[model samples]
Target: MRRAVATVLASTLLFAAAGCGGDDSGSATDGGPDKFKVGAIPIVDVAPLHLGIAKGFFSEQGMEIEVVNTTGGAAAVPGVVSGDFTFAFGNVTSLIVAKSQNLPLKAVAEGNSSTGQDGKDFGGVVVPKDSPITSAKDLAGKQVAVNNLKNIGDTTVRASVRKAGGDPAGVKFVEMPFPDMPAAIANHRVDAAWIVEPFFTTAKNQGAKVIASNFVDAAPDLTVAVYFTSEKVLKEKADLVKRFTAAIEKSLQYATDHPDEARAVLSKYTKIDAGVAEKMTLPAWPQKVNTASVQTIADQMQADGLIKDKFDVAQVLP
Candidate 1:
């Protein structure tokens, strides 16, 4: 949320590229099914969204969805703000940071949650099989890779180090995509990598060791990320937002009720192997976002120097 970054974002919004998708402008008003451009990362956490689309949950609501893949939620913030994306999936830390910057963002639905189990949650830190790092404390002064910096990956990873009696500030964090992390670890490019499934499972399948369950360390049953929209969209397209939210709730429930199908659906949009998909741990998909857990993330961000102000989680929750 630096001043220069804010300035750049504002400018970027004006010229944001309209990615693949049906137009919401004409189709929405022409009485045809409302088309929505959604931004999402290609990860296991987004399985419910794809599963729902396949099940016609969105079509049932008289909507057609076009999902635009981004590296992370933070990258899609501008797309949502600019109306290029009707809604986007993002991590809680990224959304809160956007709110702290006075961005008009509101989380419309819960995206994903941690399993709240030590060493068993969907997101954690992994190391090469023969690496000397044995615990969170060992990450001190060592380079750790994360999908995004100043976001959930590093925030929760620092929490894990702190909880394990390590100097959280002593760990060096490097930015790298989730998919590239396993290879980085294998080649000793980094000491450890904070990752989520199927990468977490994929790394373990390659004999990697799980050192810390960072998301679980962050908070109990933490709401890791959420589906959000810009405030402008909510106010301007109230009915569209309402229908999309309803479809999302049903989709979350469906994913929860049928976990196997949810795992099976990864093949449609992701390159995750079927065996890894089946073995990977799935996150909780509750209909409601965990406000308390989100508050915890906000608090962690401030403690970690990622944010300055005390973020009001209510400002972002719909």
Candidate 2:
């Protein structure tokens, strides 16, 4: 697995290094890094990062963070490969797919994880109150809106359907932003939505029925997403990567220890209603990156034909 992933990394790094063109912005600092950019979406998974910033965790490492809000991992990848971001938050599926395509990425820290409970996980598939899709099995032949197509959203949603004895490949997936999904479901533009917290809670509040906690169905305590950087940055800025990893681990631990603080920090970075943020199911932020769950996602990606390579999750780990 390591060889397979490393082989792809080697191919991408050669291409990425050629594109660098001597830009030291990724690692030009003589002293401990002062400020670096991290591309992330304003989702509940990233609340730990916001809380850490507010709590001075990164600053404690003699570093500062400038979080660049992205639509999703799809956007985060290019931003990092192009040197627009030193690091980015993305799912195991995205990073693994990026690896198969030789995108030169590496995971540095655990981003967020599933609650590992049915009906209680932070992400799920939801249908409007009057919809007939009462269970994951009912999703067969249905149109589902996901924040991104061919990524974590659909793969996990497929897992949920498969677990419920339904044909996973029969579901039709459509791409729509998380923020736009609730309205789309209510209007019947999509039969259901694979969404996460804020929207998950928001959809439920709007009388949507939760048919499945897809992340939980995919894997127990699944490591849904992670913080990552390009291989070029990993090699050139080893110090930055080390410090950032330490800080992120500390931030994740702190968030796990303080749920109230994590929930409160969401208001600072997202437009989620305070009430919804307060009551939303929070994902686990393990101090240690969960590589096992990541492997599960990698297998899902291959099973779903999202990756054509024998990618190893370990090659991307810090």
Candidate 3:
């Protein structure tokens, strides 16, 4: 088993030097000093990455990964831009915002996407069991909690509210981590929360009720997140980049083929109980980049005033 170097407070941890372990050593192809520092949140979307580490798919490619655990995608941005992390995971909305601000980054691989069908849930808005704010329109002049401000959660919720005959302009959004959302709703700290699994599963168990599926009406099958790296890494480490993505694709396939095993790995990395991990709605892993789906988000963000301009999706692809 490959043990990753772990760190807290978004601090950096060095797992292994590029060619420090294992015996190929003749360059990465000989199988790896192809070491990577990655920033990620401990959400179920990242199960495939953990699976890759556990199965040694990266090791097979002569690469090693040191995962930097973060609380949200916004927190991971600076680290990736400053080269503290060679790669990181983030929502597509956040990435688009970053690109609009001229951040030199590229998305090397896809992460989790919404399953996009009736009665299927990837993300939703939750309210207290007895709250009078029973529908999206009730959210007007109300505070809604989201993990990151001006990203997927905020954009999707606003779109959803408008579709539900509510005034999206009147709703106020606040930033709150997923773990704290259930309690926030219980205590009336916030009126509602935009959340995803396994916290969605956890919140429902805590007496919170889902008001609406966040994406189904606004934009179904949305590409929620991706694995990205700095522009410098894209230009300077071409071979290593290719190898890294190949490993990611393989890991995604592994997770799809062995969901139970993937959930087991998720429990090891996240605080989720085995039962919650088993019951949570897993994210769809798309290996190929969907420019059109990503464009849909960029267009939405621009309309929502979350970003200044629509960006070229091709510029972010690796």
lDDT (CA) per prediction: 0.86, 0.83, 0.77
Candidate 3 on 36-82: residue-level lDDT in tens? 57889888888899899889998888787888898777777666765
Clash count for each candidate, listed in order shown: 0, 0, 3
* Candidates by lDDT, descending order: 1, 2, 3
- After the best TM-score superposition of candidate 3, give how far the Cα of residue 2 lies from its true spot, in angstroms: 42
User: Runs in model 1 with CA error above 4 Å?
Assistant: 1-27
TM-score of model 1 relative to the true fold? 0.94
User: What is the per-residue lDDT of model 1 for residues 1-318, given as tens digits with 9 covering 90 to 100?
Assistant: 464266447725542554322364314676878877899999989999999999999999999999999889778777776677879999988888777777778999999899889988887999999999999989999999998777889899999999999998888999899999888888889999999988999889888899999998989899998999877677777887888899999999999999999999999988889899889999999999889988998998998778887887998887
- What TM-score goes with each of the models? 0.94, 0.91, 0.88
lDDT of 2: 0.83
Winning model by lDDT: 1
* Model 1: colliding residue pairs: none
Q: Which digits, one per residue and each the tens of the lDDT, describe model 2 over residues 202-304?
A: 8888888999989989987898888998887778778888888989989999999999999999988888898998789999888777778888888888888
Q: Candidate 1 — worst ten consecutive residues by lDDT sum? A: 18-27
Superposing all C-alpha atoms, what RMSD in Å does each candidate have to the true structure?
2.4, 4.0, 6.7
Off by over 4 Å in 2: 1-33
Sliding window of 10 residues with minimal summed lDDT for model 2: 20-29
